[model samples]
Target: MNAIIVTGGDIDISLLENYIAENKEDIIISVDAAITKLEKINLIPHIMVGDFDTLSDDDRLKKYAELDVEIVKHDPVKDFSDSELAVDRAVKVGIKNIAVFGALGKRFDHAFANILILQKYKKLGVDITIYDKYNKIYVKSNHFILERGKLWGKYISFFSLEEKNFMEKLEGVKYPIENRIIDNIATPSLYISNEIKGDKLKATFSGDLLVVESRD
Candidate 1:
């Protein structure tokens, strides 16, 4: 199954929310601040996962539709990022794939951490993608297929998130690399701006590879 996690990041209506508004049925799982974004869209979350610390102490929860909301509260003492927790819950509910929004942040630490969350999904054999106004990031472990219509960030970088870095590859991209190894360090900004000349952008990996399909 697939799910959508709405994180507390940027949700500029003119930029990214339209893409989300159209796909209403995609499970709307809100994490912390994303609850406000859901509120702005006049949509209540199907599920809310986060420590209530970010919210108010008042009974603000009753403002939504009949049942208020399905909230999964966590401890303020835990170290897990809200996004990871939400993704974990989705998996427990039989969701194998997830698309996250409002996760990439305006702050460097938050945005960087959000990108780093890709590692959690990688270990679970799940395909996860994060979207913002400027880019889209995700990963693939086994063989999968993608068509031309999808363009992520201004640049696209694929890396090996494996020990000894034994399984990283890319195809249908501007700079196609052979089966190689990449590290945890930030990748070089070279593989950006790749246009899919036609359909069929494919990649297969032995370990884990993160493909950041970005826009400039």
Candidate 2:
């Protein structure tokens, strides 16, 4: 089953509500203060994970406790972030497809760390996408196809996550490339702001690709 993790970051309430409504059968997970947001919308999560350092309301926690929500508490001195912990819980439960909301916000470090989680768990066969109001971010290797109207945003960008250069081919896009070498440091803006030309866009690459679908 698909899993959705809500972390303590800036989130668009309307987007969150609509996403949850669309995927009602997916498991819902909350991280720390994110539970407060869910409670505001009258939605209860199946799993709550955090160190409780950012969660100040004892009464609310007790209320959910009474509701039988599975709360996984961690020490304040842990190595990983609450978002990572929530992902771990989902992975441990055999949830392969994870969508993380409230992951991008004021805290740049936390946002970057959350993006790294996509690459880390991707190696273990877990597909994780970080979503915000204006962007959808994920890491992919080999090949991927983006259907024209099914994309999250109008502009699509690609970045190489590896140190070495890799050959990439792009088709069905405004700026098509044929077996072009991509090095993150050398050609940082080579594949940015590409729009789909027709019904779909296809990309095949030899290295890890950080794909960002964004809109203004």
Largest TM-score belongs to which candidate? 2
Q: For residues 137-164, could you state the per-residue lDDT of candidate 1 as single tens digits?
A: 8766766677766555335565555643
Worst 10 residues of 1 by lDDT: 183-192
Q: Residue pairs in steric clash, candidate 2?
A: none
User: What CA root-mean-square deviation does each model show from the true structure?
Assistant: 2.9, 1.1
Say which candidate scores most in lDDT: 2
Q: Which stretches of candidate 2 lie over 4 Å from their true place?
A: none
Instruction: Give the per-residue lDDT digits (tens) of candidate 2, residues 1-216.
Output: 999999999999889999999999999999999998897789999988998898977787888889999988899999999999999999998999999999999999999899888989999999999988999999988898899898888999988778544656789999998878777787788778989988999888886788999999
**lDDT agreement with native, every candidate:** 0.70, 0.90
Clashing residue pairs in all predictions, respectively, total 9, 0
